[model samples]
Target: MRSKHPPARAAEAGNSTTRQGAASPGVQFLTVPADLAGQRIDNFLQSRLKGVPRSRIYRILRKGEVRVNKGRVKAEYKLQPGDVVRVPPIRTAEQAPAPVAGDQLRQLVEASILYDANGLLVINKPAGLAVHGGSGVRLGLIEVLRQMFPESQFLELVHRLDRDTSGAIMVARKRAVLTHVQGDLRAGRLEKSYLALAVGKWPRGRRLVEAPLRKNTLKSGERMVSVDPEGKPSETRFQVLERFRGATLLAAEPVTGRTHQIRVHAQFVGCPLAGDSKYATDEANRAFREVGLKRLFLHSSVVGCSLPGGQEVRVEAPLSEELESVLAELRSGTGVPLQP
Candidate 1:
C-alpha cells in the first residue's frame, strides 16, 4: 500500500494525469490497477500523499473529501481494481533524504533471512527496530529493505512486531501474496507463537487467559492497553518453558491479536514480562537489567500460514544471542533446573 503507483502495474488515469497539478492545487482522480486491488484506501493515501499527517487523512475521509468511483468511501474501504479514486488537493512538505541504515542493522538484517521464496520474505526481525518509518523513526526495517533493493517494484510488511520484540516477521514481495496472507490473518488462520521471559516463577502447567483489553492514551501521548470489561475479547495461552529462581521462560500463543495482548495478559497473571517498561514495575525491570537484560524479553519465535496454492509455510527464529547470554547468566547464578 505504500507505493505511489499500483503495486507492480501502471495505473490508469481518470480525466487527469497521474501527478495532476501536484505543484498547483486541484482535485485529481486515479484509477486503481489490478496489483493494488486489495489495499485499504487510507493506507493508499498515506503512500500516495507524502508528508500528509495520518489525522488529516482520516479527517478527509470523514468529511467526504475523498471518494471512490464518484462516491464517498470509508478509510478502511479496500480499493477495487478499476475503481476511480478522487483525491483532493493538499499541500505537502518537500521530500527529505532517506535515512541510512547502520552497519550493525545492515548485517543483522542481511543475516536474518529465514525464508525467501514464492514472493514471500520471512525474516528473523531484529529487536529495537520499527517495522515501518513513523513517529520519529526515519529508517525502519521495511525502509531499509526498500533501500537495499532499490530496483524492486513492491515490498510491504504483512504484520507488525513491537520495536523491542525480535522474531519471525513476514514481508511480501508480490501484491497478490500480500493480499492472500492478509486474508489468512483476518480469518485467524495464521498461527504465531512467542517466547517471553516473565518476572516471577511461572506456575506449573498450561495457563489460558481470556480477558477484554482496552487501549488508552496517556497525557504524554503514549499508548497503553489494559484489561477492561468493555474492551475487545483477547486470549492467550502460556506454557512454562523453563524456570529460574525468580523468573520463568514461557511460550505464549495469542488466539486474538490485540494491542499488547500478551504483555497485558502477562501482567494480569502477576508475572509481567521482564524488561517491559510499559507494563512491568520499574523495580522488576531494574532487577532484570542488572542481570544483563537491556530490552523487553519478548520474541516472536514461530509463525505458520498457508499460501494461495495451499502450500504451508512455517518459520522459527531462535532466541537471540544477547537474550541467550542473559539466560545463561541467570541459570548459572541460580543453578535452577530447566523446568520445575
Candidate 2:
C-alpha cells in the first residue's frame, strides 16, 4: 500500500549518541529514497552498512539503537519514502578489507554470461558455488562479481539458486530494475525452467505437483523441507525429457519459489534427485557417483521475462559437459524410455 502522506525525511542532529541527545561520534541520519521504499528495515541497513553482520544489525534494532521517524520500529517494518532513519554508532574494523583478486572466478563467470542489458545480468552459475558468501564460505559469486566490476555502484541478486544447482541466475544492476523484476516474479510473469535427473523412471505426460512445503531445522542444524498441511503453498510442474535404465531426465519448473522445492517435490513423488547429497538415497547416490556424477544433477535451464519496455527476453544455459557426459553413458545402458 502506498502512503498518501509526504515521503518520510530524516533530520540528523550532529553527534547525537542515541535517538535522544548525547555526544556520539558515529551517529547519523538519512532519508529513505522513494526507490528504497517498501524494503525491510534490516535489509536497508544491510545495504547501507555493507560490512556489518546481520546479527549485529538485529541486535541494534532490538536495543532501540535504530529508529525511524523518531520512533523505534520492528525489523520487518517497511520503509516509506521520505522516512527519516536514525542510524546509531556502529563499531567497524579499523583496517579496510584486503583487496580481492577475483580474476579467475570473474573470467569463469564472464564466460558463462547468457544475457546482459537494461540493468539486468543473467549468468549461468557454475555448480558448487554459493550465490552469496557466508556460513564458512569465504567468498561467493556475488562477491566475485563486485570485484569483477569495480565501477558498478550497485549490484544485487534478484533471486537465488541453490549452491549446487547450476544455471541461469539473475543479477540486478540497479534498484529500479531489481524492483521491477521482483514484482514480475511475484506476479508470475517471470518463468524459469530447470533440468534434473532423478532416480527411477518418470511417468509420461505433464505432471504438476501442488504440495505445500514446510521448512524444518533439525537438532544438528541441518535445514530440510517436507510436505506439511500447515506449510506454505508450493507448486512444481514436471515433464519427462528422457529415460534411462534406472533414472529419468526431467524438466522441472517451480511455480512458487520455495527452498528446495524441486528436490523435495521429486522426493515426494518417490524419485529423489540423482547425486543429491541432502535429499537422495545414499545407495542411489553411491551408484550415480560410481558412474562419475560428482554434483547434483540439476541445472537451471531457461528463464523468460518481459521488460518494462515491452520487450520479451529469454535466456538459456545448456547442460554442463560433465552432466551431459553422464547422460550419454546412461542412455547407452540397458534402460529404455517408457512407451506412451
Candidate 3:
C-alpha cells in the first residue's frame, strides 16, 4: 500500500474538470489513459462528470453529443489507450464535496480484510455499506478503498452484494485478476454460500430450487425481483442448518447469478428471509426486529474460487455480533415466534 495519489490527466489540449451548476465554457477532448482501457464509455463519463446525473449522461450518449475517436459510439463501447474522447459542454447540479471516510470507518474497513494475495483482495463487507457510490450514496466501499490505498492503479469490485447484505466480497487490485475471476463467476465456477434466517420452517425434502427471476423497477426507482416464467433461469440449493420454533436457519447457495435470486426464491417457497423488507412480509420483519435483528438476515458466509495462477482460495466471514445474538436468542427459545 503506497500513498501516491491517482495519476494526473494527459489531454491533447485543455484540461477537464467536472463543472457544477453550469455548462463548461467549451468542449474538451481527452486522450484515454492506459489504466482506463477496457472501461465502458458511459462509466468513464460517470467518473469524469461527478455531479452530472446518470440520465443526463445517457441522454448525451443517445444524442451523439459524446464521441470516441471523433466518431459516435454507443455507451457500451470500451475505451482503448490513446483514443481521443470528445466531450461537449455539460451542466450538472450543484453538489457538495464528496464525503471522506471517518477514522472509525477507516479502522473498521481495515480490520475487515479477509484475504489479500495475488492481486485479489477480499473483505468481510459490512451491512448497510454500498459497494460503490451511486443512488445518493456519497461514499461507498470502493471509494473508501481508493482513498485509503491511493497508489493502486486499478481497483474494482469483482461482483456486487446488495447494500444490506454483509459478506465475503472480492475486490480486484488488477485488471487481469478482475477478468479472470469474473470469467469464473460467469461460468459458475465461483462458489458462494450464504447464511439466511428464513421466516418459517423449511421442508427437509426441498433441497434444490429452480426458479426463473424477473427484475422490475418501480416508479420510485426501487428495484424488485420476482419469480416469473419468462424470466432468466435461476437455481439455488438450500440445506437446513437449524430449526427453530417458527423460523429456520438455512445455508443457501445460488447456482445462478440473478438479481435478488435468493430472496425471491425464498419467498416463492413461502419462507422469505427474515428482515428482508423488499421480499419478506411485514409481520415477519417486525417479529425479527423485535428479537434484535436490525438488518437483512442474509450473510455471504463463504466464497471460494480459483485464481489465475491456479491458486485455490476459500474465505468465510463469521456473522456479526448482532446477528449472532439474534440467533442465540432464537436457539434459546426466548424470541417471539414468527409465523409463516
Candidate 4:
C-alpha cells in the first residue's frame, strides 16, 4: 500500500507569510487572522498560496495533508479566528509569473469605478475581462486590482459576472464588508438586474420562469447549463423593455443565483440570448453577427444592496458603445429582420 503522506522534501520549516512568488520548500504553519474568520478553508489556502495551483490545493486537502488546529479538515471547513493551519511543502515558482497590467488598462479600470465607499468598491467591469485568473487566463480583474492597490491588505470579489457580460461588480475592501454583502445576496436582499437582447421578440407581459438547472460538462471540458428536474431550483423574472424587428431588449432579474440562470432560462422560454455562441442556434448567432453584434448581448445593468454600516447603495453601468451601436442600427431598420 502507498503511504498516505506526501514525499518529504528537505527544507526549513517556518511560519507562512502572505508574500507572493515561490512557495516555501518546507512545511508552513499559518495562524488564521480574525478578519479571515468564516472563510472557507479552500479559499483561505488559495489566498495564502498565491502561486500554487488550485488543483494542488484541493488534492492536499483531500489527502488529509492540510490540518487546522492539528486536525484534518475538509476543504469546505470554515476557518475561525486563531486557528493554526499546517501546509505541506510544494514547489510553486515553476509556474510563470502573472501578467502585468498596462498603464492604459489601469487607467480604464480606474475610470470605470462607480462606487468607492463604506468598504465597498464597485466598477463597471468591461466585457472580455475575466473576474479572476484561471484556465488559460493569466491575469484577471482581481489580480489587476491587487497590482493597482498594493497598499491595501485585502480586496475580494463580492460576486462574479461572466467574462462576456459587462456591468456593475462589487469588490469588498474589508472582510466584514464581504461577509455582509454576500449575506445580503444569499438572503435575497440584494437586487441585481441585467439587460439582455433575446433572439426572438419576447411576449408582452412580464414572465417568471421557475426552471431547475443542471450543469453539464462536455467531452471537450466545456461547462453548460440546461433545464432538468433533478437539478437545483432556479428562477428568473424577465420583462420586455423594447421590441425590435428581430430581437427583444429585456430586463432579467435572477431570483435564484444559479450559474447561467438568466441565459438558460431565456432559452427555456424559446428566446435564446443574441450572440450567445454556446446556447443560441448558429443561424440566430449568424443573423445577429450580421447586424453588428460582436459579443454576447448581456450586460449587468444594476446592483442594489445595503452595506455593512446600514447605508444603501444602488450602482448602474451604462451599455458599452458597441452594444449601444448595435441597438442604434436596429432602430434604424437598416438590415433585414431575422425570421421568428
Q: Give the per-residue lDDT of model 2 (tens digit) for 69-101.
A: 879999878788877887776655421242364
In model 3, which runs have C-alpha deviations exceeding 4 angstroms? Answer: 1-43, 47-88, 92-96
Root mean square deviation (Cα) for candidate 4: 4.3
Q: Which ten-residue region of model 1 has the weakest summed lDDT? A: 1-10
Which regions of candidate 4 fall more than 4 Å away from where they truly are?
Answer: 1-15, 18-31, 40-42, 53-86, 93-95
Reference-based TM-score, model 3: 0.82
lDDT (Cα, tens digit) per residue for candidate 3, span 1-340: 2212112343632246556656565566777766567667876887677566655677789899987876999976878888888777774433445578999998999999999999999999999998877666767898888888989977887888999999899998987787678779879999899999998888779999999999899999899998899999999999999988778899999999888888899999999999999998788888888889988999999998888888999999999999999999998887556654
Full ranking by TM-score: 4, 1, 2, 3
Q: Give the winner by TM-score: 1 or 3.
A: 1
Q: Highest TM-score among the candidates is held by which one?
A: 4
Q: What TM-score does model 4 achieve against the real structure?
A: 0.87
Instruction: Give one clash count per candidate, in the order shown.
Output: 0, 7, 0, 0
State every prediction's TM-score relative to the real structure: 0.84, 0.83, 0.82, 0.87
Residue-level lDDT of model 1, residues 98-145, one tens digit each, is 567887888889899899888899999889888877665677888788
Q: Which 10-residue window in model 3 sums to the lowest lDDT? A: 1-10
Cα error, residue 90 of model 4, in Å, equals 1.9
The positional error of residue 246 in candidate 1, measured at the CA in angstroms, is 0.9
